[model samples]
Target chain A: MALPVHASPLERIWHYAYLVICALIFVFLVAPILVVIPLSFNAEPYFTFTDKMLSLDPAGYSLRWYDSLLTFGMLAPDAPRDGAWYADMWRNAAWVKAAKNSIIVGFWATLLATVLGTLAALGLSRPDMPWRRAIMAILISPMIVPIIIIATGMFFFYSNPCSILGFECGRLTSTYTGIVLAHTILGIPFVIITVTATLVGFDQSLNRAAASLGASPRRTFFRITLPLILPGVISGALFAFVTSFDEVVAVLFLAGADQQTIPRQMWNGIREQISPAILAVATILVVISIGLLTTVELLRRRSERLRGMTPR
Target chain B: MADLTAAAPLTTADGRPLKEALARAQRRAKTRAFLLVAPLLLFVIVSFVIPIAQMLHRSVYHDGFSANAPAVSAWFAANPPGTPPDEAAFAALAEDFRAMKAAKTAGEAGTRVNYTLPESRSLFTKTARDADRLAPPYRDAFLAVDPKWADPEVWQAMRSSSSAYTSDFYLSATDFRHTADGGIERVEPRQRIYVYLYIKTFVLSGVITLLCLILAFPVAHLLATLPMAKANLLMILVLLPFWTSLLVRTTSWMVLLQGQGVVNETLLSLGLITDSGRLRLINNQTGTIIVMTHVLLPFMILPLYSVMRVIPPSYVRAARSLGASSWTAFRRVYLPLTLPGIGAGALLVFILAVGYYITPALVGGADGQLFSNMIQFHMSKSNWSLAAALSAMLLAGVLLLYWLYDRLIGIDNLKLG
Candidate 1:
């Protein structure tokens, strides 16, 4: 790809122009996301950069938005800075409650998706698996199908859980179980994808060798296969967690006021009114995603190295 | 081969034929593999597949008119098409009106009929309120109560809606209406939205996919041609956005594109235009296209880069060495090699954009809205049947593209990094 010295002036100009075009495209890709990181620190109650802020005046920046994230829904905002004040903030802040709900729902959904998806991936990766293509398509369809469709269908189906069985039962809507199940379905494709990919590089003979050495099937799985595939499983679990954390449409349809997750809360905020507090929340989520992305990337590298696909 | 065919089939140690034994072993393996996947398969069927099926079923099935207007339904069943209403038909209608009045289900029956005949729900309720006064001359008495009921179109609508399951919703969804003579015709232009919106959704998605491909091509090419360390450094810029929360990215666009937002401010300060000429970017089609192209650019870039990275630079060089011009080598040698990536990325982006809801909801006000937003609008209005029908249409379109993607580029090759 290096430019040749024997090339003509026209070719040299084209090469430089191509690089400049690429640089602008990269800026287009990254700038909007990075813009919010600084705007979240704006002292004035605006989404744009004030002149002072742009000029790098120290007085133009503040932690007011981050502070508002704590006090917006609390019982008292002017209370003294004490343990009770902190307790009150944690107890009643709307954002705090949303973060809690997001974590709880994400954890259970990730656990369920990872376990079920890992098992299914193992079955699918087996050479003698029956109807693999069709089954894989079915499993991955929750991802391919539009979220709005899934949300609407879940709305009706969850409204009456037992009606499909020709009986009466309680509703799953507005409950933790319903949200978890919906998110799990949404998260399964990622799990299946990542784990199955990891298994592609797996050496199946290890399990056979363990079995041949008088180890039971269960022992072989726990002692050899699980250990080898743990990185993929963890990465899949992280992906599932993030998917649930970021999901909004399903939550909007299924969650009641008491079960509001972060995205749901942010949706209400943006629709009702845009506040700097939302930007604060967005900033924190960006940080979290950065952390999760790093983890997954490192694990990917570790898995590749472990499988001897990369040199040390 | 003839000798082998003549010989007896080879046997295993236990005297079973080898072919039978081998087949049995393979069958057992397949069953075991299937067993491992059965729990998830059943879970998905119950939680995902069944719910979607039920939603689709709701599009064609509503028991409101059939269950509540039993007498009229029975009379219609006894009679055939083109049957003029007689004394018995009027008597049956009066009986059903009385029954519906007793049950307080006039509204439900009216709502079901309202799908095909607008404002007919009020007709049912209005008639049922005066059902107690109707005399034996039921046909004349009904005409006196509501002169509109004398219309043949009313009778046609009622007859069509008498069944528990009908295709009226699908007809209405596609902007066609049932005629007075029992034939289908297009609704008036003023009322036709779904078909137009469907077309708009597909066309807008196509434009966005094309924009994404244009924006992503050079960047992907650069990444593919760069040295490894440099490419990885630039890759972070792409992956960071891919991993960011969708809401976060969408909110950034909102902040950037709003009228008083940064983009306008920057343009205003730069004297690009008068302050009055600030672009109406947000809450319009331009905003939707711009934001979506940004959001989906990564999808195009990743696939293109993955495809391009494996392409040998030697081919293009050899073309140049053999006296082919740079443009000629690129057009003939490189472009064809990248076609698969283009197809995959375009289909993926187009499918996602077609069903996109959140971005359009926030920024795509009235004229910019897609088909999914219309479905949501119906759902919020509690018009479940129309919403279900629209969703079914969207789902069908998406699944077709998905199947196409699977055929052209195997689903197993779908990558995320």
Candidate 2:
């Protein structure tokens, strides 16, 4: 709200103080995250800036921490820089392997979540869908429930998925399949939320018109509905991917040593050794999140525009 | 025409009855819609709901004792509680001890009973190891191995655990233990943890929720009142942290708040405090609160901003014009109007904060741990029953709030960016 000209001096002073307070809060919100980026490059194995860094000396900055990300688990970390060294890093570096596992699990989990969640969102958004509220709650309850509870439950159930059925089977724990299944459950709510948000602005009449024009339901979805909602679906998919990518508790409970994702590795790194390498990883992850956030924002604006709604 | 149609159901042009056709079509549409959602629904139920239900079952049931000591369990079943150590009971214990020794499950049985009767696990294993030396006077024989066998409380524990299921874990979770007389009593003062942690979890969560609101309100108001473009740009300040990885945020906090970290360093150079007076910020209660508030602040701001943005600034103007001071106008008009947002944000943050594990686990040292950390501890220790019980309690509290949330805010209105 704009300050009125008739406002008293105390009111004007309070307004200025309020703005300053808001600015400080904003700094509190953002400064900690922004603080890590520069510190990640500190020449020393320290969490703070050195005098050289304060003075803007080139010697104060180093890529050693980022370099350690590649060389930490490499079998021949000290080998000369060559093709074999790069291959060793790709194959054996702890962070690289963890990143690979994260991508694999995130990709499969997002795929499954997007497909199943989109279908459910479409159904839930329909007027004739039965038991809509109850079903919607069940679908998204994973998000509301604490990750520890969900992880604990999955830890027990996945260990013996058939235990409740009075039978024995192979355990799902410590397996990629189990991790993917858990991540999918965690990601499904985001997909449902984003996709259904888009569906809210959908014009069902277009689908009806396509049907009246003798287009089959599948044909109509592929041709008319899919094109209009692709942005939403993609947005939902990205959300699901991010959810899977960022998940750690489930990985901690369900993953084996071989299934270490980036978060899992970072968790171990943080707990066992608070190295600058972790800060380096955190910086890279921060950049990735910024990119993802920007992408989602763009997609959201495009979705609004495609639906013929004015962008906020 | 009406009379004719009443006698013969209304027919389409092709002479088919329209009523049956329409009913069948409607049924098909309903089925189709259900089929679309069926896969995900089933997936969630199997992967999510059933596992939680199974965990709840574990909370009340552990078969470690019942499955191993079949003869003793059966004897306890035939006899009622408060039954003294009769000859038959001692003989059954001897028999089960022999079986346990053979099956190498004395440790298992004792572990189960130890959950209720502390230190009895060693007695079970110790007696089971020397079962071969037992004589016909079984009561004396068992007592000779360990005088604790004469304690009725041990018998009560075994009796309660006689079946494959028992509520002992739940009882213990609420800080009560079974007495020798077959009644529940609070555990020793020194041993009580779960209830204290629960209260602390809620109180701390309440405090954190309040802190988040205080920090968030001004920013949310600023953002909501600002022009759209500037608000969106400033919103990045909020969204970046929201989008950043949780572990990263936690790590950054650790860096900033650690004793030798930036904050302390700055404070030290400024003479804010002497070297020895450096704040014990990380790995304590204050660290837990600060990190959690920062993490959950976005949750509060988004909802408050959304609500304030649509409040039709005229409401406050109306109040101001009616001889109300700016402060009075805000208090009377703006504050009350934002109540819904306050309630939603507070409940959401509290619910989330109550269940927070990773943040408190990482930043919270010994005294800073929450209820969820206790759950994680039990899980890691392979104490599945206790973990499940603690989880069930946490889940109950969460579900109640969730129900409150659904009733108040409507789950459909739950939004994320």
Candidate 3:
């Protein structure tokens, strides 16, 4: 395609203005995160960069914090060799445990929500499904309801021991199962919405073609339908993962001290202590989130391309 | 021809009525679709809908008064045209109070009454002890224990409980109702909360939505119009923060904006001030707005960028070729074309902002707190009814805005994908 030429000086000025504003925003958006990344490497255990660093001194460069984080008394099976450092690390152990809980909760919630949500999307997208719009609206209600309300409801419902199909499960409040279930409830909507969007352009004809070629329904789905929808499934799963990982308010009421997730840990850290180790964790989290999101974006684009819904 | 005709009927088999021999197949397909959706539907109903319904029910739930105090109800039911028949009814109330005070679950009842009328505790206790006495003077003494009871104010409150449901919390949320004294009044001026908070929430959400658009528009434009490779790179950069925990992002803002943090440090180093700037970035309205705008920008950008991506470049080129200045072309043509995106982004950002709790709580001072904070407060205090009432108001507000936006812009037409 031939590129359009610029027309007027006013247009040129407008373009430059647009570019300048965008550049400024990009800096504003990225600056704090970038600042944290380097500060994570600071030899000093404070927010400030040291004088040595200001003067380009090599002594300022130390991986002590990183080493401290990994071997931090929080993770140590025994007390640290250094007593003071061990106490400090032990003080931070709640945060480490919370972060660990966050990973487990995020993974399971994401996996379950994505699988269930994808199935829901497929079922809803089928032309013959009755009350598709109503079903979708119901599925998406969790996304619309305020988190506090959801938290309150979950608190009440799970505080009492409830039985399902004669299987007596005790009160779920303060349990890992409770938090994961709550997180999945929150995560599933995002997966459903995104996957449904992906499914909108999916070709039923391909599945029909496979079926006509004497493929079993299960085999056709696995070989043809699943592959075409893989990108959607991945993106949906990533969205679910991010949603669960970042969730806090619902978990706040549902999770006990033992079940505290990373966000809750960070919440306490911010409220109680102004530790730079949190900055380190924040930087690490930002990196991981960016990586995951980029992959999601790529998957989204690939899904669109695979469905031939948009130009590559 | 015969083979093809037979195959046509075979194809029709796919669409055959379930009433015929295909009943089993139709039932199986229906069962499969239901099975596929049953788990999520079950989860939402059990986890989301039923709990919310129960919360809503709690708002009007006078079980504390009705279920626990059946004697009180019976006394009212037995008392006929008022000869002040009189001492017997008082005796019955006293008996009910004695039972209520002595009951193991009395505390729960007291707590519930405390939410509505905190002073009811002493009344119940006094009535109980007085009613337990076996004398006429005792009955007169009980009546005198709180003269307010004879004034019909207390009687009215008690009588209003004839129905099992009450709208007291909802009325309180709106700040207009009759006091127990039968005085049609507003809540105490100082206790006159919720209305203002609701207004502030709406205004704050509106401000944040506008700010996101202002901040996101240029960036979204650049991302939409840049060279393909560069645009994708910039888009990723824009979305990068979104993948991180919202709590972490909000906290990071707190860290950066604190008095001794990097922003102030950079300013100090630049000789902007002799000391770190005392901007009071955390725990203020400015901080809330700034953090919220940043957090919600991705929501704005994605929709706007998606919408912008679909507008063919040829329209702008053609307008430019027709002697239209770039500003004119954009303002008159391009901007109008991008309205769908703007609408979608605005609706998404506004709705999210209204319901947001953590960002404002972390960054907002007392003056900056939104309605969601009150919702949290009520929930924690075990005032589920009032919490539900407040949430119902919020949900109504959000839905109204959405309805208005849909009416104004046709949200269905603004699909980003």
Candidate 4:
């Protein structure tokens, strides 16, 4: 907005100061992430920049910490760089195993959340859907409720799946099933929200028209509705994937010794030691989030176009 | 119409009554839609809802000692409070302790009582060890084994804990317990922790919310006023933090704020403080506040930005043209319009911050611990009842706020980056 002609000089000074304030906050937001990248490359073990590091000396940087991530939990880290070393890392490096666990948990959790959430969103979008507001609230409660409460609840629920039911189903805690189930619960709300937002602009008349043309409901869904909502579903799936990938609380409560995920590993590392390896991991996560962000952004635009939300 | 339908039997082209055919179609549609959602709904109920409900149930559910020491439990069931420990009560306890000792279940029995009376685990095990040596007039035998058995408070605690249901854990969660005479009483000063943690959680989260609101308002205003391309570019700064792994951001804070880390080192080089005087920032309240503010700031900025982006600038300009000073114009016109965003952002931040676990766990040392940390502590110790009680209170507060948020800004409007 332009300054009024009658504005006081005091107001003008305040305006410039306000701009400075905003700029500083922007730095506050981004500088932490920026600060970690260079430190991860530091040849020194210190978190701060070394004298040579500030002087831009070549010897001040190294990839040794990244090497440590490979050998952090390896059965034999000092071995030569060969098949045995790689195999030891594959089987035993804590971070490597964590990464694998993160993938498996994220994949299954996302698949469950996306499939269930998408179907529910489809139902929720229908005009004739029963108890719409109440059902929506129930589905979305996992997102709103405090995560610690949820984790505590899962801790109990998984302790004895047979506690309430007559039949015995064995314990769910400290198992892949428990962590995956917990992540799936946490991821459902995101999928429901994203998919439902896309579904808001859907035309119901198309379904009726297909029915009038003698198309079965399943065929009509696959041929028309699924195609139209594919972008939304994909984005929703990605959202679910990210939610599961970034999750740590449930994993903390439910995952067993071998089920440690990356976040859990990072939690241990950050707590026990602030190694440059953690920074290396943080750098990779930052990069992964950037990719996820870009993909979600693109899919959002496509979904908007499919729903005719934006003019051509 | 009724007479006509009766006479003509109103039918569709398919030769069925119109109402019946339409009703059948509607029922089929409803069932089909319901069938699609049924699997997930059932899954959520089984996995999420029931767990939460059961956890709350566990808060008031105390069957540990009752289930373990059935004879003593039956004595309490047979005789109410104020009933002196005659032969039957003492004999029942003696028999139960003997069985527990023989079965090696005295530890569980002790743990159950220890929850009510701290440092009393050894008492159970000790009494169980001496149970066989006791003669008749068993009260003296019990008293000779341990003076704690002579205290009516122990009996009161036992009587209350004997039942399957008791409010002792909830009372303990709120920093209260049963007295000798069966009246609820304040716990000792040394024993009071949960209340302090709750207070600290609320106060710090309140401060964080207020800080976020003050900091985020101007940035959101600038973004809303700027050109689309510039605003979107600037928005990335906010969105990037939102998308980043929470641990990464927390790690960055740890790196910057730890002793001898970036901030302290820089200050040290600048002679701001000596090596010994480098700020104790990490693993304390300061670290928790700084990092949480950094992490949750995006949540505050997003809602404020979304709401601010819609308000026409003309209103403020029009107020300015009416001879209102800039401060007066903003206060009277601009601030009021953004109140919805302010409320939403504050509540959202507060709700999330209050339940915070990972950041506080990583950075918050002793003085900065929250209620959730206490829950985690008890959970790991297998103190399920106490953890459940704490969780019940937390879940209640969060649910209330959630309902408010849903009512004020429909859940459908909940947006993620």
Best by DockQ: 2
Tens digits of lDDT, candidate 1, B40-101? 99999999999999998999999889999999999889999768778998999999998888
Model 4: lDDT of residue A312:
24
Look at candidate 1 and give me any clashing residue pairs: none
Local error of candidate 1 at residue B13 (angstroms): 3.8
Two-chain DockQ for each candidate model? 0.77, 0.81, 0.48, 0.69
lDDT tens digits, residue span A115-184, model 1: 9999999999999998899999999999889899999999999999789999979999999999999999
Model 3, first chain, TM-score of: 0.85
Which 10-residue window of candidate 1 chain B scores lowest in summed lDDT?
B408-417
Q: What's the C-alpha lDDT at position A85 in model 2? A: 94
Clash counts for all predictions: 0, 0, 0, 0
Per candidate, native contacts kept equal 0.72, 0.78, 0.50, 0.73
TM-score of chain A of 4: 0.93
TM-score of each: 0.97, 0.97, 0.88, 0.95
lDDT of 4 by residue, B1-417 (tens): 788867987689989988899999898878877877788889999999999998999889877789889998998888877887777898888888878878888888777778888888898888878867877788888889988887776787788879878888899999998777777888889989888888888899999999999889999999999887688778888888888998999989989988878999889989999999989998888888999999999999988998999999999889988989778999999999999899889988998998998889888887677778888898888898999999988888788888898899877777665
lDDT (10s digit) by residue, model 3, range A84-136: 65665656666566778988998999888988888887887776666665677
Per-candidate Cα lDDT values, in order, are 0.91, 0.92, 0.75, 0.87
Ranking by DockQ: 2, 1, 4, 3
Where in model 3 is the C-alpha error above 4 Å? A1-10, A42-53, A56-92, A161-169, A308-312, B1-35, B77-86, B122-139, B143-152, B161-163, B180-183, B271-277, B401-417
**What is the per-residue lDDT of model 2 for residues A1-312, given as tens digits with 9 covering 90 to 100?**
689889899999999999999999999999999999999999999998899999999999999999999999899999999999999999999999999999999999999999999999989988889899889888978988989999999998999999889999999999999999999999899888888889989999999999999999999999998888888899889888888888899999999999999999999999997999999999999999999989888888888899999777
